[model samples]
Target: KEFTYLIFPLLCFFYDKNTRRKEKNKRHCFLSVPRWVSLSLSMCLSQTLNRSKMNHIPIPITCQNDTEMSSRDIDYTVNALEVERILNYHFKNKRLVEDALTHSSYTDSVSYERLEFLGDSALGLVLSIYLFLTYPNLDPGQLSLLRASNISTEKLARVAIRHGLYRFVRHNASTALDDKVREFAEAVSQEDDPLIHGGTVKAPKILADIVESLAAAIYVDVDFDLQRLWVIFRGLLEPIVTLEDLQQQPQPVTMLFELCQKNGKQVDIKHWKNGSKYIASVYVDGNFIASGSSEQKEIAKLNVAKLSLHKLSDSRPTKMEGLENTGELDGKSEIEGAKQKLHELCRKKKWPKPSYNIKDEGPSHEKKFECSVQIVTADSMLSMTGDEKSRVKDAENSAASLMIHLLQESDYL
Candidate 1:
């Protein structure tokens, strides 16, 4: 009798389980349980089957959503299709597109969190490859800066706004987000300078994420085809910053450091907190050049650098009279003139002689030499390269002349 009662309970348990499974399958709802819960249930069922000497059957968990789409979901699908059109590529799995556009705040079936993670890495790789091939002469540091400027939040957000990608993002953020989007759109429309390398504008991160997630979605849809992904996105990321652009107006901090190093001045950046704002001061050769304050230390530093640059420009002498007065340019060849001026400046500053590195290229009969002059200041090393010349001495002289001209322009001489 007791055994019969045990069998009855087991039958009831199986019948309830079967009923629930049928209902779930009919509704087409995914069964998402915690990992711990699933493991605990599996172990308990295995133990029970072992005790009864019966074969253990594994339970199948469905990860797909089989349920009917709500009105909102249908709208999301339509919007996603429009996004696909904007992207100029179709997804074999449409769910990937939907997931990419859905933000965590939406509380939908799934968000773009996973895809965003994947997209971040993919975007970095694509940009790295693009910059590396496009700028063959750029060093690793220059390549990094170029990549960072392109993939920055402001730049990516600008991309999203330009391509209408932000319209398809399924987010439930506050009105502030909408306001920010509108403001950003307006800012972009009125922007005379589109480059975000100066860090003057504030961009919403979600807009950037949308761009990245979509990139990831396309990558996955194409089965991780990086070349195809670049082809599609290269146009979307228009006005690609080139090496010339970076050199024309390098980052303020970089410009300041280079100027200080070339002028044999030491640059020191000091930071402090003033209530809620952060303050940064730039010191050149023990003198306080300029100070700036902002909520962010980086911005503050940039501002200080800009101010210092202005100060240096205003204080610079207009003529090369100092070089003439040094008695280094008396009846000498142009090459000797350049070398003597550089040596005199180094001696005045009590610094070591500048180093010259020369390289010869081409055949023996048509050989060309390239020279680079490296000046070691107290705090930094400033290097400048000159054009190729037929003679090594000419190349070195060209480098030295270039250095002197630069120093004069920056008011160092």
Candidate 2:
């Protein structure tokens, strides 16, 4: 009888277990959790994935509300089709390109500043290398002058505008692009037909900024290889970059003989002509020793030659100890090793130079007293002359010191 009772309970327990499972499964079916969740998750995933497939080319600023029919939309400067064409030509990495076209003014979420920084550096390196290899005989100063002029913001902007960059740039919804940039660009484009050019010009700075941003965009895209950059650069600089023309670019030192060895064209540098009537002058970086201007191209060329000679004269250094010998004044190392040596010698002779009046000048723990000693020692130059034993050598050293000072001031060093 007991066995029968236990079997009955066991049977009941098995029935209960099956009942609970059925109820749980029934709940699952009613909620449709598996089907619904899967669908939502998949849709979200697809949008994320599709972003990669679509190139970042901008939609036309004019097409913001494209009912497909109105040319009256002047709300934004750049158009979608123009952006698409430019990006399609230059960018391979769709994702990278999108990031580049996105102006900070367009949205608060992302920016291209980092990409801009990177692109600017890359362009500079590439252009410098091109100049180096192309003008193998050119001196360092000449190469740098060419590179700087070529890679300048204004030049880049002009290129961008020619390639339809203005079509992609979006201004604040409220403010149209500055009128100056528009006017200058129009004027340049329509040089042959001033009435058609509308005499509109864009601000040089604005145009350039947009161009740099575009370069950064192209850099992010995989399609823009070194060859592509070179091609673009060559086309843009074609007017000025011929072998013969490069010779006319300034040489702060004598490079005429070496220039002659390059591809033979009459070594002439003429003022570069764009649609604008602006003058181009050469300087070794920013230090200007000469200026030249003329209506005739050869006249302008002669002026550059004279300027190069002037540059040579201005730098006529009596103390041209090739960088290896500038000692403490070498290049950018401003540390005063000689001064410290002098101070130690003075200390040994019981003539410890006084400490510096100011303190904490650099990265070292070099005390204010050490700097003061240097200053005081410099002031005590007269006292050292009095010692008769060292009088003759002292005068000679003083004369040498005076010569060094004179050389520094003369510019003909």
Candidate 3:
């Protein structure tokens, strides 16, 4: 009778447990559990079955989620479709792309931080491989520099802006971000040099994060295929900086130092901060030659260097003639009064007067404007648009400056 009672209770317990397992499987079919949890459970179940001497019978283990889409995921899917269109590549898992574009500020969802971390390493590795294979003649140092420049935060940020990838990012409304993005965009639009490290404004890291996170999203979507990642990114990062570009346009600071060294003059740069602005002064042989200011210390230094180069070159035109002729020296000073310069150039060439189109955007209190210049030709339309600025004139000048630089570089000035 005691043996019968024990068997009855054991049978009831097994029946209840099996019923619960089946119900659980029905409710959760997504199987989103971590790998370690699945492994641990499998081991425990195996040991229990072995001890119980029921190894002949099979026990099923499953963990899953409901197939119905969550409201949040549905919203993400819409955005994901737009992003996929921009990337020209569809995603097998839309959630990955959604997570990539989401900033940490957006609560209750996965952020791009983890994906950015993965992408940082993956991007570096892929770029290193490309550099290694593409330029077999380049030494390690040269290759390292190329890799670093190509994968730099500034470069990636530029790529994000150039490709309009920033528009898809999901983040909380941030005034600081808006201002930074606006300033950087303006700087980029005004800049005509592709090989330059960055434009007048410092690039925001958020932009770079978006790019890296997107790269990781693609990498994961392609099953961690580095080759596939490269194929997608190669086109996104257009106008890749080449060895010739690097050699032709060295860093402004480096160029200035070399110029001074050749002339037996000591180059000294001093930096300080005034309010939100960082100021840099260029001193040659203990005499202050020129000064420049920016929101970034490095950019301020570079600005002063370029300004000093202009001053030095003008002071000894004959000595710097060779450098200027070879296009090593920046003709950046000509960009000043760029509107007038463009008008004069058009008048001189007997081309139609450059036409301007202005756009005003943002809140009234913090309004921004952008300008685009177009010069219609018989066979083509040459146009340039500047980054948004606080003033319409500044925006117009920025656009004109870019156009002027392009013309000068093409030997049409």
Q: For this target, which candidate reaches the highest lDDT against the unseen true structure?
A: 3
Candidate 3: worst-modelled 10 consecutive residues by lDDT: 57-66
Q: Per-residue lDDT of 1-413 in model 2, one digit per residue for the tens?
A: 34434443433344345577765754454355454443443333334334434564432111112244334233322344356565455433333444455556766324556667767776788788888888889889768767755665545666666776655554454444546666567546633211110112323555655656666655445334666665554554334444333332222223432322232423333257645332345454345545555543433444465445434433444233322145423333222343344434445544423111111223334321111111112112111111111222232233333323332443422
- Model 3 agreement with the true structure over 215-281: per-residue lDDT tens digits: 9989877757799999987787767777766664555677678777777989999999999999999
Q: How many backbone clashes does candidate 2 have?
A: 27
TM-score ranking, best first: 3, 1, 2
Between candidates 1 and 3, the lDDT winner: 3
CA lDDT of every candidate: 0.71, 0.43, 0.72
TM-score, every prediction = 0.54, 0.38, 0.56
Reference-based TM-score, model 2: 0.38
Predicted candidate 3, C-alpha RMSD: 12.5
Candidate 1's TM-score: 0.54
Q: What is the lDDT of residue 230 in candidate 1?
A: 94
